[model samples]
Target: MRILRTALLVALVVGVSVSALAKADAPLIDAVRSGDVSVVRALLDQGADVEGAAADGSTALQWAVHEGRAALVELLLGAGADVTATNRYGVGPASLAAENGNASILERLLDAGVDPDTTMPGGETLLMTAARTGEPDTVRVLLARGADPNVREELRGQTALMWAAANDNAAAIHVLAEQGAHLHARTDNPSRSPGRTFSSTPATGFTPLLFAVRGGHLDAARVLLDAGADVNDAVSDGQSGLVVAAANANWEMAAYLLDRGADPTHAGAGWNALHQTVRTRRMNVGFGTPGPFAAGTLDSIDLVRQLLARGVDVNARMTRNGIRDGQRNRFNRLGATAFMLAAKVTDVETMRVLLEAGADPLIPTADGTTPLMVAAGLAIWNPGEDGGTLSGQEDEVLEAVRICLELGNDVNAANYRGETALHGAGFRGANIVVDYLVEHGADLTALTEDG
Candidate 1:
């Protein structure tokens, strides 16, 4: 009878203790979530496990950091919470705190001997994540905590400073550089090239400054340049910083890079920076659809001047034969030289800028079309005769022709088909252009082989 009573009492005591522990677990997490510090302290004193993970495999520390509860985070850390604990997404406390710019929480975690360079599953360290966040505070704090600024991510092998430049975060860039981040580290991601990133067209690899220029972040680009980034670094596709800037028509960055001694004449895949800027100038508006007018015309002209000042050949032709008249909408692909590209622009100011900078007006493309012929054809172009900008286009074309003539381009230059400017002007019975061509010294009797 004594043994039975003793066994029964011990079993009851064990059951009550298990019940208390079970009761303590639920409220601890609840307290942390509700930001009830007192309740959390009480549960901790009552023998609740500090590392109790929630359903998402995240502990109270993860919750506190994610909720941006700095005070709660401190309390939890003091209670022996694991600073390196991550949620289901592999996002750890340090990454969360860095993203939130929670400096105090970060400091606490670091002081507790948590590695400042702790990264997620994708190899995104605290510094890389914070750099792209555009807030420099977290970046600075992490650097002070001994985060490696030169550490690369898994996918692109890009460093923290490169991520900042890629996202156009100037403030973050400033902070990272102040702590000795590398400026010219190149990406080594194979997936970025040869359609490996899940598409047919390949991607361009980048340096930190290349990303800044590609993103059109003028201030960020300037910062990178000042940090001794190489202006002439090229991608796997051989595109330099100046070339990318010109390709995006980022005239401001282009000009600044040019001033910083970036090569203006550097060509990639047969297209030079000068030729790319002119290509942008030459893209025509769609028929009968109003489009945003091309902006930064004056900036473009200034960029051209900078290129000329750099001693780029005023008549540098492409290294490869042009792609012309394909189903890819390649027509009048006079992408051969800056002057010929100016002819395709049909803008008087662009033509004037090129001519003033010593771009020859009479240069014929491989197809033998001249600025005079291109102007005459565009002047009489009637987009269904009902397009709203028809009058403006006609005026522009006429002005383009006048500018070409004033620049002394040959009036009688013919193409590979033996077709003169009149042939282009009189195409599809465009008599307005034919009459204009006739008045401007184009011979009417000139004919192609078929004619």
Candidate 2:
């Protein structure tokens, strides 16, 4: 916005200007920055150049805008400061005003005939800047003055609408959309990150509707839908809004999408909403989550119920995503069932929800690893939580083991390795689960194919 905020700029400009003119008469720049009106007037009277730049190419006018000094901005402009001067990041006075939503300063710059279409170094225009900063009023003023809402940023080809959608700025989104923003525009050449669900699609495949879901902006999503966004629209990989909604644990959005005709059973990249809904962290999270506390166990449980009621395949399995090795990888080796994924997680509430919703506890994968064996084989403490007494966590995992046994999953069932659920527990030091399994008739002498 301001190239950087004052707090950060203060840190960046730790010493004197590291420039060739380190000893030049740069008091006008320093005075304007400190908001010392008397010193600024004195510098102007002393024939100081009003358009002088700092080490980073930031002109006095740009610094005034950053400091929110409206009077100083006007004074500098009247003293022949160039409104078009920019900083190292190509952010000028006008762009800074719009980004900060400083309407008064922005009006003066716009009235001075500044071109609103000019972009910063990264192709961010005034409207895109305002939208990213959640500034509806600035967006309205710019649009009214003939700013192009559909103008694509040069780098990512994102219009102001895309930025609005990404930031959850529903008001800005509405303003831009009403001003003729393109609804179905896809980003150009999106960055590729393999470790993300949003990356299930290739670059250049994200639409505004998909971005809304990715941002978890329910109101913005509804606005787009009411404005005629295609509910069934998907990325190039066929990751529909419904699948994203569920995968992101956005139950309300998922519900709305289903009501709007999104396919509840749509699968993308060999996985469905069921796989994402039950996943504790990896798939459903850690891939640019909206916020740290945005997803929760309660929401996941609710989503599980919603998907089940909407007729998603409860025993839906995702093939083992990639090559697997090591005995501890058993849970993932055999294509994972939703129940299996949930059992390996500590959130037993979600596991219970799936179980109650008719997820088969004994469903086996290609290698014969069932959800029961997966739960029993899980380590009592996560690697991060190792070296602690395993009582609390052991109880949680044992809850899944108990549920599986009570529901008739074989206590002695083995995987392709011939390792029983009891053996699985024994491998991971799940003594509590081992005792329960043995009490339920688990064979003590079972051996893996390796043994």
Candidate 3:
């Protein structure tokens, strides 16, 4: 009984002692976190440990640096606070200072022997971080302190200029360029083996200008172009800035590139800018949301006009089955033309535009699937979707079908699989298209190769 009572007494004493220690530590940390310089100094005078860490392993100096409190940082440093203390994320005072664009705090950290080019866990450098922050002064400080402007990160082999361009930091781009950053440097492109096909993921082989263009940063792109960037530079798959702009529905950027001497006829491995523009327009506006055309839609139309005026082939065809959302499907898009893409989505206005521009309606896919057949629901381009049609778009699709037939298309044309428009209409349960095809002399007894 006496021993049990002694053990309880010791437990009570230990608990009180730990509580007292926590009380002593909390005030200093709270003072530092709140940027209360006087209170932090008072706590230091009261013999608080300078190296005491918060719950996340952030020391007083690190917190001061993170808070951008230069005076507090100086005080902590004078009190012998550890500058190298890191938090749970491996972020130290220097990293916080660099990311916050606090040049003074970063300078102090550097004066305390921190490397100006300190890298994150992923090998991203301080210059890259500052460049992404869009603060030119922070980037300049890092560069002046010996950070490499052209240093490539290990992950993507991207430089500080690439980071700046990607984040739309025009000032940082200017600074990096003035400091001799390689304006034409390309990111690492993974080597493709022979006979091995790659998806169009935009994963590699991007220049800083391509990054800017892909991000839709017109200002950044302008800065890059002014810096003598090649407007026709392409990725590994041969997609130029103009093609990327068209694919992303960034018609403004596309127009800008065209104005700056971008090649309108540049064809990537998959599709040209025209095909991408049609496909992306469908994805953006959807099948039939009834409203006035948006400003972006108008811009896209204008861009299409510009491409046509620049001698872009209105009858251009896709060279390969480009990247799609679902790759497991049996949909093959090779030899598809812009007019065919417009018909597939039942885009009546776009179809009109293409037709007026002399887009051939008789062009077919590799399997001989014609634009008229596609308009009659003859193919499943993206399976599990309603053949790219919406609830209120039956009339528009029927109009597209009418336009195709009026263009002298053969209604009884069969693909390689012996499937006609009637087969596709029946498979899709498109009663409107089926009735129209029957009235237009579509063969009712026509059977597929399977039949």
Candidate 4:
């Protein structure tokens, strides 16, 4: 089977080289494909352009590098093929060799004076490319050859540190940092700061700090803060590391930022950390979260309790103004009464903790989505899929509904989409929830806009 695979690969290479030669200077590329080092040497000896590019901008050296023909690559390089020259897409031979995980060929090119830090067409440096492809050896080789660890790409100014952080390449990130990669440099948030232009400023005004937090790298976050990096540095989007930590449910990092003077009040400011917590706890599965410390070891419930105890203002608002045209709406606009995020497994406990922590169950979300509504809506999908109803626990959803009602939740409140909790229940075929709501005197005659 292995022999068959080898033969197939060889045939494919031959076929591709023949096709490429049919278009432009195919013979040299074919010789490289066939691993005919002597033939490649002869072509170069005859003054055929070793660096002469094909129609796709690939030189003979690039074909050799792609095929892992180390000796052929060396021969082309000896013939003065521009080892640093990039193809049309900016991927040079070094970068391709790294992509193919050919560390030996990469070292040969580097030793022969090929530039390892060269950027491809889209601004990916050979080092960045190597790290992304999980070629740790190639990464080491590039770094040893003085590839700029802190080199920022074109669009977002992401240094190798940022790339490693975003991809959770801890070892590569550490190597670059240990080699004096700037940990505090910021990159552009193109998603938030659209229409922004790139500048050569060393201070990208956005650093790798928040990315560390977003990645939930507690150790990395500690390292950055210990290096005197700003714990409260805000991104171009006006969000801080504290906010990202909370978004990622990195409580340890969140707690660390708080200890370092991170203001949780600045988080979901108009919405509040407690408010965001309620929403986030609902997406626990989506976030790949582990349940809180322990059922008693500080479960999600206890974690919420701790944040509140730490002065995360439970009643804080997320946005100041109400909704408007062409402007973002604040999460606090849901009548500033009792609100509920959509239900998830952790949300049940989160709701219980919030009620215990003084979260107003009366205020609806900005769009009039209520806690009971969320509970009922989630019950319909059986999001927990624990063979349960919308209320989750045998009585948990009902208990939460009862709390909201006791806290003055308008059982008749309708969302902006004109759906009520009962409608949501009926829509999702949650008969248990429908029956429970009816028993609790829930209005059944209410009609929604969609209905």
Best model number under lDDT = 3
lDDT of model 3, residue 339: 89
Look at candidate 4 and tell me the lDDT of residue 74.
Answer: 70
- Cα lDDT of model 2 by residue, 71-120, tens digit: 89888888988888776656688887876888788888988878878676
In model 1, what is the error at residue 333, expressed in angstroms? 4.5
Whole-model alpha-carbon lDDT for candidate 1: 0.67
> What root-mean-square deviation over C-alphas does model 4 reach?
8.3
If both were scored by TM-score, which would come out higher, candidate 2 or candidate 4?
2
Candidate 4 Cα deviation (angstroms), residue 101: 6.6
Look at candidate 3 and tell me the lDDT of residue 335. 90
lDDT of 4 at 431: 72
Model 4 segments beyond 4 Å from truth?
A: 1-55, 67-70, 97-117, 130-151, 178-180, 189-206, 217-228, 246-265, 283-306, 320-339, 342-346, 363-399, 406-451
Local distance difference test scores for all models: 0.67, 0.69, 0.75, 0.61
lDDT of 4: 0.61
> RMSD of each candidate?
11.9, 5.0, 9.4, 8.3
The numbered model that scores best in TM-score is: 3
Give the per-residue Cα lDDT of candidate 4 at 207: 72
Worst 10 residues of 1 by lDDT: 193-202
The sequence of per-residue lDDT tens digits that candidate 1 reaches over residues 1-451 is: 1232243234324323424335435567667778888888888898888888654455677667767888888888888888877655566778767767777777778888779889876677888778877778788788887889999877667788887897788899988988888887777777644111101112446788877877677788888878778888776666677766765567777887887888877866565777766655444433443322333444667777778878888888866543221123333544357766666545667677777887888876667777777666632244322112332355666676677777776667777777776765564245565676678787767778787
TM-score of 4: 0.66
Clashes of 4: 22
Over the stretch 1-451, how does candidate 4's per-residue lDDT look in tens digits? 1232243345334435444466446778777878987887887777776766665567778889888988887778777788787655555788778777688999998887788778765467888777655556788889888888877777667776666665556666666667788877877635333111111112235576776766666666665666566888765545566655555456666667777888766642344445444444443222133322211122334456666888876655446332111122222344342135423232455566666778776666567777677566432333333211232453665565566666776667888777777875665455776787788777888877766
